[model samples]
Target: MKVTLERNHLLKSLSHVHRVVERRNTYPILANVLFKASDDHVELRATDLDIEVTESVPAMVSTPGATTVPAHTLYEIVRKLSDGAEVRLETDGGENMVLTSGRSRFNLACLNPDSFPDLKSGAFAHEFDIAAASLRELIERTQFAISNEETRYYLNGIYFHAVQNSASGSLFRAVATDGHRMARAEIAAPAGAEGMGGIIVPKKTVGEVQKLLDGVDGDVHVEVSDTKIRVTVGPVVLLSKLIEGTFPDYDRVTPKNNDKQMLVDKAGFAIAVDRVSTIASDRGGKAVKLSASNGLLELSVTNPDHGTASEEVAVDFETDGFEIGFNARYLLDIITQIRTESAVFLFNDANSPTLVKEEGSEANALYVLMPMRV
Candidate 1:
C-alpha cells in the first residue's frame, strides 16, 4: 500500500480517530489504527471494543491496500511534521510500514488488518437529522452530571428519548444524574425521532461525539437501535454500544412544588460560593452554607482543621428565610452552565432538593442539586 496525503489532512483525521484507541489494551491489534487507501482517499479507523470512530481524508493513492499501525506513534509523527508538507505511507505487504515526510523517515511495525475487530452496526430502527449546534448543546449541558459509579451503571451516560405532548408537540430530551445532581436539556424533536425508546449512551462515547461535533455547522445524521447507536458527521462516522441497564425515572426525584424562589446574579453567586469554599475541607464534599433572608444572601464555609470563610451577595428572595448547604463543586458546575444573567433557585426547605433554572432557558436546560449538610 502506497498513499500520499497532505500532513494537515492526515493529522486532523488522526486526531479525530486516535482518541478511540485506549492507551492500555488487552489485545495488541486494538492499540493500532486501521488505514485503508483506495481511489482518491484514505480511511482511518480506531476502536476500543466499545466504540468505533472512522474518518476519511483526501489522498493520492498510487497503490490501494490496507494495513494497521501504532495509532499514537503515527499521530505524534504527523503532528510534528512541517506544515503543508506531503506525507507518504507505504507498506509492501510486510511486517513494517514506512512513514516519510520531507527529510524525516521512520519505520513502524504493522499488524494484520484482517485481525482488527469491527463493531458490526447491523440495522437502526430509528434515524434522524439534527443540527450540530442543537446536538452539541444537548450533550454539553448534561455531560457533567453523568454518574461515574460503576455499580449503578444505568446512570453512567445521558438518557436520550423523545417526548410528545399536545401543548408543545414533540421534544427530544437528554438527562444525566449522579444521584446527587441532575441536568436535563431539551430541543425540538427532529423529524423521525418521535416515539423512540430511551437509550443510555456511554459516557466515553458521549464525550467523543461532542468533540467531533465541535465547529461543525452542518447537520448530523443519527441512527439508533436497541443495542447500538451510529452518528455520521461529514466524512466521519462513529458507532457505539448502548449501555444495557435501565436509567431510573428521574422525574420522580425532580422537585416540582418548591415554593420558595430566589433569583440571584449568576456571576456574583458563583464568585461568592467559590471564595467561601476556599477554606472548606478538600477531603470530602466541600460544603458551603447559604443563608438567605430578607434581601441579603450570606455564603459561609467552616472547617475544623482549616479556617472559616464567608461572603455576602444580594439576592431576590420573597419567601420565608431559610438556610441550606450544598457541595461547592456541584454548585459551581451548575452555575457555569446557566446562560442568563440571573439564576432562579426554587427551594422547599433545607432538606429538600433545590431546583435551578436560567430565566429564558428554564425549559431548555434545568438543574437539580441535592443539598449537603454543613
Candidate 2:
C-alpha cells in the first residue's frame, strides 16, 4: 500500500478515530489503526472490540491497499511532523509500514489488515436526524449525572429512548442517575426514530463523541438496535455496543409534586452554593443545608473538622417553609447543568427528594436529588 496525505488532515481524522483504539491489547492489530486506500480516499478506523470509529480523509493514492499500524505511533508521527508536511506511507507485504516526512522517518510494525476484527457499522433498523444544537444540549444536560460505578454498569451511561407524556405527547429523552441524583432531558421525537430499545452508551465513548460533536457544523444521524448503536456526524462515524442490561426504572425516582417551590436566578444560587460548599466536607455523611422560609433562602455548611460557612440569597417563594440537607457536590452538579438564567426548586421536606427545574423553557428537563440526613 502507498498513499500520500496532508499532515493536518490525517492528524485531525486520526485524532477522531484513535480514541476508540484499544490501548492494551495482546493482539497487536487491536492496538493499531487500519489505514485503507480505496476509491480515491484513505479510510482510517480503530476499535476496542466493543466500539469502533471510522473517518475518511483526502489522500493521493498510488497503490490501493490496506495495512494496520499502531494507532498511537502513527498519530504521534503525524503530529510531530511540521504542519502542512506531506505524509507518505508504504507497506512491503504485511510486515511494517514505512512513514516519512522531510528528515523525520519511522517504521511501524504492521499486522495484516485482514485480521482486524469486523465491527458493525449498524445498518441499523431505526435511524433519525437531530440538530447538532439539540443533541449537544441533551448530552450536556444529563452527562454529569451518569454513574461511574462499573458494578452498576447499567447506570454508567445516559439512557436514550422514546417516551410519551400528556404535556409533550411523544419525545426523545435522555436520563442519567448516580443513585444520589438524577438528570432528565428531552427533545421532540424525530421522524424515523421509532421502535428502538433503550441502550447505555459507556462513559469513555460519550466523552469522546461529545468532543467530536462539540464543534461540528450540521445535523447528526443516529442509529440504534438491540445490540449496537451508531451516531454519524459529518465524515466520522461512532459505533458502540449497547450495554446488555436494563436501566433502572428512573420515572419512579422523580418526584411527582414536592409541595414546596422556590424560584431564583440560576447563577446567583449556584454561586452561593459553591461558596458555601468550600467548607463543606465531601465525605459520604457530610451535607449542606438549605433553609427556606418566606422569601429568604440560606445555604450553610457545617464542617466540624474545619469551620462553618453560610450565605443568604433572596428567592421568590410562597410555599410552606422547609429545610433539607444534601450532598454539596451533587447539588452543584445539578445546578450547573441548567441552561436558563433562572431556576425553580421544589421540596417536600427534610426526609424526601428535592426537585429542581431550569426556568423558561417548554422542555421537560428536571433534576432530582435525594436529601442527606445531616
Candidate 3:
C-alpha cells in the first residue's frame, strides 16, 4: 500500500482514530490501526473491541492496498513531522512499512490487515439527526454524573430516550447518575428519534463523541440498535456497544414536591463551596456543610486534624432554617454546568435529596444531590 497526504491532514485523521486503540492490548493486531488506501482517500480505523472509530482523509494513492501499523507509533511519527510537509506511506506487501516526511524516515513493523476484527453494527432500529449545539448541551450537562463503578454497569453511561411532552411535542432526554448525584438534560426530539428504546451510551464513547463534536456544526447523524450505536460526525464515524443492564427508573428519585427554595448567585456559591472545601481532610471526606437561614447561607468544612473553615454568602432563602452536608466535589461539578447567573436550589429538610436548576429558565436540565450527614 502506498499513499501520499499532507502532514496536517494525516495527523488530524490519526489523532481522531488512534484514541480508540488502547495502549496495552492482549492481541497485537488490536494495538494497531488498519489503513486502506484507495481511489482518492485513505481510510484509518482503530478499535478496542468495545468501541471503534474510523476517519477518511484526502490522499493520493500510488498503489491501492491495505495494511496495519502500531497506532501510537505512527501517530507520534506524523505529529513530529513539519507542518505543511507531505507524508508518504508505502508497504510493498512486506513486514515493514516505510514512513517518509522531508529528511525523516521510519520503518514500522506491519501486521496483517485480514486479522483485524470488525465490529458489526447489525441492523439499526432507529436513526436521527440532531443539531450539534443540542447534542453538546445534553452531553456536557450530564456526563459528569456517569458512575465509574463496574458492579452497577448500567450507570456507567448516559441513558438516552425519547418521551412525549404534550406541551412541547416530543423531547429527547439524557440522564446519568452515580448513586449520590444525578443529572438530566432534555432537548426537543429530532425527527425519527421518537419511540426509540432507551440506550446506555458507555462513558468512553460519550467522551469520544464529545471530542468529535468539537468545531463541528449543523447536525450529526446517529443510528441506534438494541445492542449498538453508530454516530457519524463529519468524516469520522464512532460505533460503540450499548450496556446490557437496565438503568434504574430515575424519576422515582427526582424530587418534585420540595417546598423550600433558595436562590443564590451561581458564582458566589461555587466560590464559597470551593474555598471552604479546602479545609476538608483528604483522608476523612470532602463534605461541605451548608447552613441557610435569614437570607444568608453559611458554608463550612470541619476536619478534626486541621480545624474548621467557613464562609457566608447572601441568598434568597425563605426557609425557616436548615443545615445539610454534601460532597464539595459533587456540588462543584453540578454548579459548573449551570449556565444562568442564579442557581435555584429546592430543599425538603436536610435529609432528602435537593433539586437544583438554573433560576428563571425553562427546565431543560436539572440536578439531584443526596445529602450527607456532617
Best by TM-score: 3
Between candidates 1 and 3, the one scoring higher on TM-score is: 3
Point out where model 2 deviates above 4 Å: 121-123, 284-286, 319-321
| Comparison by lDDT, 2 against 3, better one | 3
For candidate 1, the 10 contiguous residues with the lowest summed lDDT are 357-366
| Candidate 2 per-residue lDDT over residues 150-252, each given as its tens digit | 8999898888888766786678888989999999988888887644567788877778779888887678998888788888989998888877889999888
Clashing pairs in 1: none
- All candidates' TM-scores? 0.98, 0.95, 0.99
Show the lowest summed lDDT stretch of 10 residues, model 3. 278-287
List candidate 1 segments past 4 Å from native. Answer: none
Error of 1 at 132 (Å): 0.5
Candidate 3 TM-score, C-alpha based:
0.99
Q: What total of clashing residue pairs does each candidate reach?
A: 0, 0, 0
RMSD of each candidate? Answer: 1.1, 1.7, 0.9
Score each candidate by Cα lDDT: 0.94, 0.85, 0.94
Candidate 1 lDDT by residue in tens digits, 57-117? 9999999999999999999999999999999999999999999998999999999999999
So what's the TM-score on candidate 1? 0.98
